[model samples]
Target: MENNSPRQRQRRRRPKADVAPAPRRAAPVTGRLRPLSQEDMARISEASFDILHDIGLSDASPEAVRAVVGRGGQETEDGRLLFPRSLVEEALAGLRRDFTLCARDPSQDIEMTRSRVHTGSGGASPMVVDLETGAYLPAMLADLYDAARLVDTLDNVQFFSRSMIAGDMETLRDLDINTAYAALAGTSKHVMTSCSQAEHVRDIAGMCFLLAGSAEAFRARPFLSLNINHAVPPLRFDPEACNVLLAGAELGLPVMVNTFGQMGASSPVTIAGCLAQTNAETLAGMVLAWIVNPEVTAIYGARPMVTDLRSGGMAGGSGEQAILTAAATQMAQFYNLPNSTIAGATDSKIADAQAGYEKALSVTMAVQAGANLVTQAAGTQAGLMATSFEAYVIDNDMLGAILGAASPIPVDAQTLAVDVIAQTVRGEGHFLGHPDTYARMKSDFVYPAHADRQAPDAWLANGAPTINSAARQAAQETLANHFPSHIPAEIDRDIRSRFDIKLPRERMRQA
Candidate 1:
């Protein structure tokens, strides 16, 4: 919040808040190789290849090509290893500079080229919410359906980053593929392979692989990616699941290594200590990945915010969350990698004042600090236990304003008030109506709203809706704007086949 002072204004009154600052930051990047010695690279390369043979991927069943070896038999009942050394490097060689993530609808296609892209979907999974009704309830399928639709309409979403899911693990696999397929069908773009069990991650990766035409397709044009939520096992990977991340890398897939730390949980009371532990794990993962395949293109991710010791859930609404995210952004930039953190996430259940304030602050700080992709951009409540559809909608709007911030303008001419200088005839000098006034003013202004303000009566009149209402409206409007693409019927069929669910007529109609 820049200060608007009369004394300051009198001192210099040429420029207004509308003028954008010059672009100072470079484009955010991902999958970057930190400067390593040739020997180090060799060691990492050796380590990476060794992993393929020694640590094979488990649960790869598509008849995709038995094991990473093509003869071990797909879906090893006893955790079979598929990928070999050569394949990891082979796939990495073909990865592209950038690609498009097809939305469920064609119009929603996201361009993954420039840096600083933020996106999300599925605020909540249909987990067993022992509502006032009963125990072990799944997320509403319509909730996910609406989420996919919301992903289509939200401009901020770069990739269909999955958010929430149904809590039932028994049916999670079906739901995972179901959600991915639904996102593809309803929206028309490539959806993301997301956070599920290790097997499910592999399954989704395979689905994405098939869609792009080959095991290498996603590597070249990876619209779909996944997250390996690292267990902060004292800065170590659970040996069982770490293998999954290695396998994904060998497959030339992108992944978010989200290492979360809660204050009084895995993290200390201080932000720095918390960040250090979290960052160490994140860096170690990337290091191991560089060992696996420097080409894997990892995003150093963290969500090290304070935790509520009493409840043992993430304590949202602390100013430290954004600060930690900002600091993490700096760390990522220091390592020349893209950083992923949260946005539009708050512990508040209903979208009320607290939700609005926390989400906005968390989101804006992350973007401003340079998180390439804000993960939890919308639909966070009750320590991520619940989500509001309306909150997500508002998040989209918030992003429009934030992305606008990324395009800051700065230059000698723009900053230098030439007209003001000229108008200053040495006496009543002022450039209130300078020729460049209108143009400059339009460039850098995020107008205020009544709710964002403390206006009492004004807030009530405008529906006085909670975040739930706003998210619901957002989700509704998002569905109304669904776009479709011309994915080949064969490709569409193959994608659906994996799910063992037939594509509905609605999908075919999407062009």
Candidate 2:
């Protein structure tokens, strides 16, 4: 008997004329908010070259000094590494301009070329915002895994960076290894983490190689990347971080050359001056990556925080920070380099009104200005010192609105709906039941799950939950049941046996 139900018959007879375009992992933002004009970018680039040639970065590593000098850079008697303009230009031309960051699951790979505007969490905050108890406490390894799990389910958050440092780990070695393990266990999306020593980088790679089935397979499609802070403020190389950078480069891993120059403190107070110094610092890192292996994929990382001159403290939530992030994005474009910057951080301790405004301002600017990757874009508070689980859901809704604001609206024959308007005017005086309206209902709009949109009386009937409370409920539901099965059990056991993974297997299991 070949009997078909009504639902089955409807599904079989569905029209093929309504085929929608394939959605991208992250849509490329076309809006351009270049605070610095083309002339200004040129002037900034020239000034950066001057700083590199004249003021030169301080180098402590013998290998780095040799690599630079061998490549036409000069070393002063005081040990400052001087880069000639030609050398900087040559490195810029030779650097890997574009690449894809692969993930454990092949479907989650991210294209790192152009201004694609992928937002993710960052900052490696040391504290966690306990929404249940409403207390800020030292973040633990469990929190890190939970954060990754939450990110895996978020649509707007494209990738997961180790958002919080595992402060509960007794040693730095344990912290680094466990952080890597937790992030991997939590999601199959592209994961990025940092290592305290160069050896940790190799150890993490070995773990990843095992997960990928072989060394060659891992190298062919390396699923993990490193975010190494290759230099300290005021132009000095961090020796240990430099080693990590070189290790990742030699292994052909994607290395983000993060440079942090605080305005009015580590760098000049003016926005232009800060960009110039940070740009020079970024160039030095590129040269180092070139010295390691010219084929290494480079991500031009900028985290130039603004300082409050009145109190001599960080003002990460200020408008100046957002402006600096957008301006630096323009500089990365000027060099034709892939870029990432910090946004969405707030000085507010909780995810309240203050946090809302602070995150909205910076995140919007970064998206509109066309940053390739914007870190600290979710689950951050207290000036990048803490992460809140509830904030993840709330920020996801906010990021949806921001993406909507940045995404272009199509104005085609079907979209314009002139015929639909005429039909409505001639007949029912409404087009809600029209075929065109029905076809566009779900695809043409972003419906937020945590944000409230009910009528006043209906809202009161449902207990009138605040955004934070609604977000908390949503986050609780996700954490309670969303356990991903990307990594096989046998592979997980092998990894645990091979490395000192601190996160318990039971913790990853859903209720």
Candidate 3:
């Protein structure tokens, strides 16, 4: 047993030439597409200001009215709150331009600054595509947790923004709290969720405190943010959502004043008209957030969606939707504010050819235009009506390639490889086994984990597999094996003791 055979000796000395390491995580890529000229942006800004001043908005909560009117906002005879241009300008000037979206793991922190783009999962889809059955089903708390685990393992999905609504949760409070819990338990990445009531904001913050060890600790690096839909399109504010926005701002939680206006339905049919209205609504939300807490981190989330005029249905994956979102990013750039937009919400029910092309087209446009945060960029389907675990796996490969395309290219001496080219020409006649090839292969190329790239013979020998089938297998494997334990057991117990935690521990771990 002690004698080493020839085979064992040869195995020990085998070269590791073919093994390639994983590509580095994508850094924030600079946006280079400009859909709107300076003159176009100026006209849109003026139109937005006029809308805010002339039309104003209705149904502002009493607290919001007081906060805004106290700061020189006027109220029309019709009870609509009007924001003065000067006041809006003042709030914009005072907004916090750059802040870090801290994660449970410090290395995952996202810098919220200029045209540096980031993409992640987001939506409130009520249904999920069953991974095994291939049937559409109601999304439960368990489905949300599993999706979070999938997102946790995804290299390109940078954050989790509560992709699915837990239809099993009966009460709104339970829904709000458990949604946040599932996201927190499922990933160490920065999490974002919505609160049903202002009081529920405090409850969620307390749970975050336990996870971070103390209230001070959580506040120092608050990992959770609220996506507050404070504006209801066509010039109005949702009073309840505004209250939640105020509560979140009071707690110093980073908030996105998200506004969605569907063209030809909730908003004007023309693209410019829709943009102007949504832009005004977004600015109004910012004013309210600034009034409550001047230091609060508020993101300009102006999502102007498109509607299929023929059917009056949401065309979230249409070319019009793509350009509209990119133009919104340009508007945010004009104001020098951190912004977010929706992309890749394919109308296709499954991850088919339609879904693939739709997602790639919209995501490419959004990222190229430089959206600070591109939500709904992964795993969304059926026009944001459904979520798919397998879609997350397939979309991860697509996101990596899109982000890689957006990455800056260097044109320096080292990258030029003049010397390496000359030496290869003189000696090997090719660069296949060259040292520079070995050094740059991993750094320069982004290999797909789910997409296939095999020759015809190899494919036939390996049992020709579709991308969907491969992604399904990958999703099932990851969900069965990966379970994040960033929050300790004792802390989880405390969290359950205080809140109505519904996701069973056994479901979270392998048996």
lDDT against the true structure, each candidate: 0.55, 0.84, 0.89
TM-score of each: 0.67, 0.93, 0.95
lDDT per residue as tens, model 1, 287-322: 445555656666667777777667776766667676
- lDDT of model number 3: 0.89
TM-score for candidate 2, please give it. Answer: 0.93
Instruction: Pick the TM-score winner.
Output: 3
Residue 346 in candidate 3 has what lDDT? 96
- Highest lDDT, which number? 3
Clashing pairs in 3: none
Q: Model 2: runs farther than 4 Å from truth?
A: 1-26
Candidate 3 lDDT over 1-511, as tens digits, reads 1113232233234332222336446565677888888999999999999999989999999999999899999888898999999999999999999788889989778888788888899999999887767789888888898889889888789999999999989899999999999999999999999998999999999999889888788878989999999988889899999999999888888898999999999999998999899999999999899989999889999999999999999998899999998999999999999998999999999999999999999999999999989999999999999999889989999999999899898899999989999898999899999988898887888899879899989988899998998888777767656789999999999999999988888777753
Ranking according to lDDT, highest score first:
3, 2, 1
